[model samples]
Target chain A: MDFTAILGAWIAVGLTLFILSFLYRDNPLFKIAENLYIGIAIGYIFSITIYNVWIPKIYQPVSNRVFTSLSNWVPWVSKFVTPAGDAGSLTPLFPAIIGISLLTRIFPKISWISRYGFAFIVGYGAGLAIPATVATMFIAQIEGTIQPVFKLASGGAIDLSGPALWTSFSAILLCLGVIVTLFYFFFSLEHGKISKKVTKIGIYFLMVYFGAAFGTTVMGRFALLYGRFFDLYTYRTSGYYHATPILILLVLIFFFVYFGKSRKTSP
Target chain B: MKNGKIAAAVLAAIFFASVSGASAEKKKIEIPPLEGLTARDMPYDMGAAALLEWKIRDCDNQDMTYRIFVSSLAGTGPALRSFTEAGWIKVDEFKGNERLAKDIELPFWAWNASKNIHAVKVSLDNFFGKIQDGSVYYFKVMTLRGKQISESPVVPGAVKGNWFNLSRFNNLFYVILISMAFFWAVTHAKKGNLFIRRITGLDAVEEAIGRATEMGKPVYYLTGRLGMGSMSTIAATFILGEISKRIATYDTQLKVPHTEPVTMTVCQEIVKQAYSEAGRQDAYREDINFYVTDDQFAYTAAVDGMMTREKPAACFYMGYYYAESLLLTEIGSHTGAIQIAGTDAEHQLPFFFITCDYTLIGEELYAAGAYLSKDPVLVGTLRGQDIGKVFAMAVILLGAIGLTLAHVRGWDGLTRVIGNLFNSF
Candidate 1:
């Protein structure tokens, strides 16, 4: 690796160690790394939105159509004139105005103007979401749940083999799970004896689902933790100049000194 | 200029001789016509396409391929036409023995073609000029082997827009039934005739707020990383409005950190209006709702820092969340804060259920607003949703029994019709 790449690896190693120091306690190093993370993320997102969204969608089209059109009388502006396909229309002005109106919330006198933008968003969002939800989530889920239950043999008889019977049992269990889960969340009536029993079974199903999900999530977190530790291990090699071990030593000393003084001063 | 003209004339003569020679070479091999070629309008679609099928039982050559040609001429019956003709367009080409009828997504009730034949859907709108609906279109298939080609007889099919897709009848029925239920419930709710069962999580909101007020620590509320377009965020805002009103009445500090700008803007108005409703507008601070960065982990880190520093007495996590759910809730639990979380994101539920003092699962998150406020409209909507669930359960039960019986009895017709009714087009 080049000198700059090695330096970058060193910095990355130091920062990772600083962040991992939170496992010890919240110290100055952890706070520094946390603030740097937030600051860098804000800068990255702002630049991305400006270049990928605002400049292409708003500034370019408006400047091409409006500014390039003025180049007929002023010749120097012709240098920036775009093709006819892009410069022929002013259709982007309305959304730009609405976008600007959303920023008016900062000004106390005109803050109410932002409501027009929010109202448009909510109204359009609901209009698009309702039919899609019904088609995909509500209707399609019901269709998938109510499946054909039996497998037919080649001669048109019911198959009663072990695998086929297991599939049929699974289908019935799924149907029962769906109905009982729906009962558990039914808000209209109080639960009587039968309803209570059914909902209790539903709660058991929910707990199993939660347990499986928790195991997978914890496994995923461990994999991410392993990735960070492996990086730190690799950086401890001589080519990276022992950046991990040295930085860790310095952090340990700082922690000891910082806590030692505070302990001596306390009652 | 004279020399350039002479070079161009010599090149043209060579190209003409090569074209004639190539045609002669192609005529040396004899390939038979593709048999049983047919074209018909594809069902249950706005008429922009035609489904073409043909038999290919004997070809084993790996290099052989089929080419489809279409024309807008109305009555060009059965005779082979030159593809270089004015209206003909080569729409598609693929290897033989591919694109079987089974590969197509047509419903079983409408399409009963055997799985053995090759099928392709030709979109008429893709031709050079727009092919108008209600006009006749002709299609032909060509089989090619090395330098030789054999053309099938031309077949005609009309294109027309379908008024309705018969496959989505069950969807329409379910929507109409639920809408009528909502209207009926709304009318009855006006007379205070609706009952919503108790949700333990909502009952604890008051106690949590009272604890925060007595301790004189701020109550932190987080609307998760989704925009106003999501139903979960909207429900979260409703619950925020109710919570903020109670906090306003109690004269406790409330801080709402947001990950989406539009949601932050909406929740600002909600909290302001809430405080105004409780006759404590002076107690509401404009900075109660503030924008954090839109980046998920950055927002999580900033909020984690705040939670660690202030150690708020209570934390309310609502709306949709992703991986940051665990990071935020784990810190809240460590701070010894009373945390109540409500979300419809199923994957994130396990984290919240383990960390929070109370958690409202899937639909309960949506119904919490009605349960807390006891508002007629919201309560009516909740009851309507419950009735819709009943409708769904009844269908599931009856459909399961009917499908089982139909399968055991080998009733193919009933199975197809019922299956097609529930299938999405």
Candidate 2:
């Protein structure tokens, strides 16, 4: 292995051990790792925001389209020109105009101009999302719940018929159950015997659904944990190095956390 | 030079006029018939899904209208039959006034009726027509302008096939993880390790409830409006089940206000069951686990009103919460109630940490249910998660060192090796 390769491997091992020190107890090593993680994550996010959002959406488009247009049309207009002190400087005017409008948001007296920009964005987003939400969420969910269930006959030959009468009946019942249950929670009406009974049945269906949902969630968590463990075992078995140094580092970090906690609590 | 400039200008004007005249003349063009229509696998996310794309011969856009027709390969009619036996049986049917779109997906349910279907047919029609069964049908797309119809080429439908074998791999991984976790938990339990879980939030549950009893005030518990898919809700429900039992023993009043009607109903049942298990079913009140509203801010407003009116001495905010976390917690704080909150939402963790007396972070929320119930299945899963965490730590350290060494020493091979390892799974 090359020197840089070995160094990279060692750093990975050290950082891993540092983070794991928390399992034994939190101490300086764990603290350092935690700080590094936060710092790196923040830095990455900052750079990503600049590259993806600021550059493409704000800087590049404005400079290329608006500034270039101004420069070609009104060259030698010194006052309106961009990059300042240049004769053909209308390039910076576009961003400046936007900046001025945004700055108005900070001033209480001039904040009304900011509403124009906010209105445009909110209106556009709502216009696009409203139809999609109605189609996908409301319509699709209703369709799914209304679909009749089917069962196979004892002969095992594929039955090519529509859902059984009972299945269709149950689908209607479930739909009613959900609706009535929803009505029970409606605050406009006072609690009554019929509403109370409907709500009680709704509770039963809710429990079975929640139980199944809980089971799925447990599966998801276990999957994440399993994936992590798989990585650890695979890496260790790769035999990149003696692994003694990493083991010693972990042990030392654990000792520090244990001793530090003991010292803080001692009478 | 002046003469040459004038000549160029004249030529340019002539060329532009001629080009415009030619484009206007092209408007009377006739459309060609469509042909070679076919449907195949879409490039991406093609599992259980296929794209049916066809080419129309008619070049004019005005004459392009296509109607898609689907029929069972088994030539079975649109009759309802028993799932086991295949015969026409009439059920309910709805007739619509307007014609439906020609190109649409026929979900799995539409197929499997009969194996005799040869092909699907598409046709162009101003009005919807009745579909005949037990016959191979081909679709014809045509353009309609006024009463004129320009027919396109016809194409047949193909049989639907399985998209991919995703279930096989998923099942394999599920079995492995479940077995591993079960074995570890069983082994540990048998060895009597007395697994000491570090859960400061759970430990403080008693203190919070007791304070409410001392104040002679009811304790309020809320499981946020997040649907059943949320892990936080599961943890909250399990914890609530345990807490309900404790409150029953103490004979202290407990109120749980829910946002979703379904969740409210579930909470009521869970609380009732817990109280029954504690042999104090008499103390259980159905109205306590009541539903508010589904509207987010509106629900928050209702909850705030309830909190102010009831003035519960203790509040437990558990499960998935959004922007309302702070609003709820701040109001509870104002009421001088001791609040303990737990959530898996990374964004809301800061609010819980600063406002609540005790907070559970990330995986700790999952551990809460197992810790309280000591359910073998849950405990086994937790132990398995611990093993997974340790494994993750090891990988992170190894990967870091490998990367560092490669960067410093210009080890191209080592870097490649590390990259391959990361991508392998």
Candidate 2, residue A228: Cα displacement in angstroms equals 45
Q: Model 1: which docking level applies?
A: medium
Tell me how many residue pairs clash in candidate 2.
47
Query: Model 2, A32-86: lDDT tens per residue?
Result: 6655665565566668878987666566655556555666777764256454222
lDDT of 1 by residue, A100-185 (tens): 89999889899889999989887877767666677877777778888768888788888889998999999999999989988999
Worst ten in a row by lDDT for model 1 chain B: B73-82
My TM-score estimates for the predictions, one after another, are 0.83, 0.40
What CAPRI grade goes to candidate 2?
incorrect
Off by over 4 Å in 1: A67-80, A84-89, B1-65, B69-103, B106-119, B122-140, B144-148, B152-173
